[model samples]
Target: MDVSCAFATALDSADNIALAERLGYHRAWVYDTPQQSPDVWMTLALAAERTERIGLGPGVLVPSLRHPMVNAAATATLAALAPGRVAVAFGTGFTGRRAMGYGPIRWSFMESYLRAFRGLLRGDVVEWEGARMRMLHPAGHAPPRPVEVPILVGALGPKGNKVARELGDGLFATLRPPAFMTEHSWVAYLEWGTVLDEGEDTHSEHAREAAGPGWALSLHGAYEFGGPEAVRTLAGGKEWLGVIERSRKQRRHLAVHSGHCVELNAADEAAWYAGGSGTLCEVTLSGTREAIRRKLDDYRARGVTEVVYQPCGPDVQRELERFLEVAKSDES
Candidate 1:
């Protein structure tokens, strides 16, 4: 399977994109959490100008965050820079929506957005939100807006996947192969965790710093689905639940996602103190390089066309080098 890297979006993101290009990563997907980082389009535009071949786009675009014309215009600009390398992924805003105490957008709205956005990309004037809209960029201004970038959608369940089949060119999903997937589908599985250093302790401070976000996110997902009882499955889960519970200042969501995807928050760091630390490695791609390689083989065998690995922690360069090294190990 092809391998790609994603950053949680930062000011120095272009430098990391340049590194991913040099290290042979297939793409660089920058996150779109407006509350947690910089503007996704601006960051992507910078990465596009700085690199030559590595693909670039928001990992998943949140429909509620912008107008279709805005998105279609930005895609034109980035497509101008990268040509056939841009991929537009539509998703229900996870942290981006939830931090504001909102939930995922409806699939019906997803269908409408896709129609409007893709039509504008094709230079077709489409009516949206009460008026006709289209990209009017002059020849020198942007790519001729019959810009044909591939579209992907983030979907985990039947409702969402149904929309994906109707709208997107590919599927952006969590680790498992969704039931609808066939060998012909372009499935990109999003994975998390760090490749453990040889002899590194899973519970060590260094390991937590490297892989805590993946484990903590698991806790976050569980708690979102099953509440306090759910997080009790992890080490400090019970206590972490208490911490989040007591902080229900009508905005407990703010605390629940403080360090999402990028690093561990105080509540996240607390949950890794005991035997449960091993769960961090067990649940994610956090194993030795060989272990990760075999795990990747298992995914590729299952017909995953790509593994989009999101590496966390302070040292992005090391994370980038380690993952690419593991992905290319089969050739050696």
Candidate 2:
């Protein structure tokens, strides 16, 4: 299986993308949360200039954030900078929309947007919203249209999976590769957590800092897809629900995803510090080197072609180096 790296997208993050290229990560993906991080395209653009071989793109873009023509243009531009190394994935908005107080987008809208976006990439004029539009970059401005790059679909449920199956070149998902996927399919499974020290506590301060944001995402995902009731079913779910309900923000929707994959907010830190560590290994791919290697093996068995691991906390370089060392263990 191929190993890839994903960044939470901080300022000066191109350094890490450059490091990933040196470390041999097949692709480098960045989160697309504008409110929480830098612009995805701009971040990738920097990475493109800094590195030559490692693939670059947003792991998953929220369709509602921009017009189809806008994204089509950005993709073309990134391809120009990175040549054949650019690839992108799109999804119904998660934090990308919710951080702005909107709900996740619908599949119907995403399907339509995908069609229009791809059409625009092909230099075909297509209808979006109420009017026909196409990329109008004059010659010598952007990469030539018909800029062919692989587009993946980020999904975690049946509806989104169906859309990916029909419209996308590959599948990008969190947690596990869906059972329906096969080895022939291009599946990139996004995962979180750290390679723990021998016998180290999963809830230790370091672990909490590195894995907390990702664990918090489980709560955010549950609350987003299944509501408060669903979040109540996970470990420390009840207390987390309380944290969300009592958030100072007038709109709890925004509070639910405050830290996202970057850092743990007060609510996220509290919940994980309270008892969230108990299930860290259960929900996330965080564990020891041996354990992580096992998960990589299991992923390949389940049709995952690439493992896009996103590290968290203050020491990103440390995490990146360690993950690459272990991920390459299978090679030796």
Candidate 3:
């Protein structure tokens, strides 16, 4: 499977994208959570200008944040720089909205947004707020007409997947594969890390800390959208149900991004390391490099085409280098 890097979206993101290309990563997916991130399009434009081979994109843009026409224009600009190397993914806005004390866009609205957004990207005139509109770029300076930008949709549940299948060119997901995947859909499976070196602790504290973001996200998903029953199946659900309950009672899902979610209970961390969703075993590539490769083989068997590995923690460059070194070593 092809490998991509998903960034946490910082000012140095363009630099990281350039370095990722040098290290042979296939692409760079910039997160769209503006609450904790810079403008996605600006970051992508910078990356596009700084790199040649690597694909550049917003991992998943929230349709509710900007007009589809605006998104289409920004994507065209990036495509102008990267051409066939560009793709954009859309979602119903999770962290982006919650961080603003709002909720995800309704599925109906998201479905309509996807249709309009995909149409605009395909060079079709689409209906806007009240009128039909199409991209009207200046002659010659315009990116190629009818740009074949691949549209992906970030989805977790059945309804979301259905919308993607109907509107998107592919799927963007985390950890789990869809229940049913069409032959034409490309699945980008987002993983937390790829740490294979054997150490004193199989699930080291460093590794656990490296995976904290995803673990914290899982808690948000389980408690908010997935319900208490889903939360119960997670690593430390039983032991930390009280914490989860308290958070739920207080509507803590609103603070689901970094600088807040990472301040998790210690018990939750231990449970995640023990085994369950968000554990190194479940969400990351951990073990010998050979073992990690075998795990990747399993994903391919299940229809995963692209593996987007997201680096977590403070030392992102170090973690990224370590991941690429192991992946490259295996290729040789």
Tens-digit per-residue lDDT, 31-145, candidate 3? 8888877899999989988988999889889988999988888888888888789988887776778767687888899898878877877778889788999878876655756
Candidate 2: where are CA atoms >4 Å away?
Answer: 248-250
Best by lDDT: 2
**Against the true structure, candidate 2 has what lDDT?**
0.85
TM-score per candidate, in order?
A: 0.95, 0.95, 0.85
Give the alpha carbon lDDT tens digit for every residue of 1-332 in model 1: 78998888889988899989998999888888999999999999899889999999888889999999888888888998888889978889877788778888998999999999989989898999899978888989888758999998888788788888888898887744676655237888888888887998788776787778877778788777677787897778886776787785687888899988878777776676645577876678888999898888887777678788887778888887888888888446
Model 3: lDDT of residue 258 = 36
Q: What is the Cα-based TM-score of model 1?
A: 0.95
lDDT-sorted candidate list, best first: 2, 1, 3
Clashes of each: 0, 0, 0
Each model's lDDT comes to 0.83, 0.85, 0.74
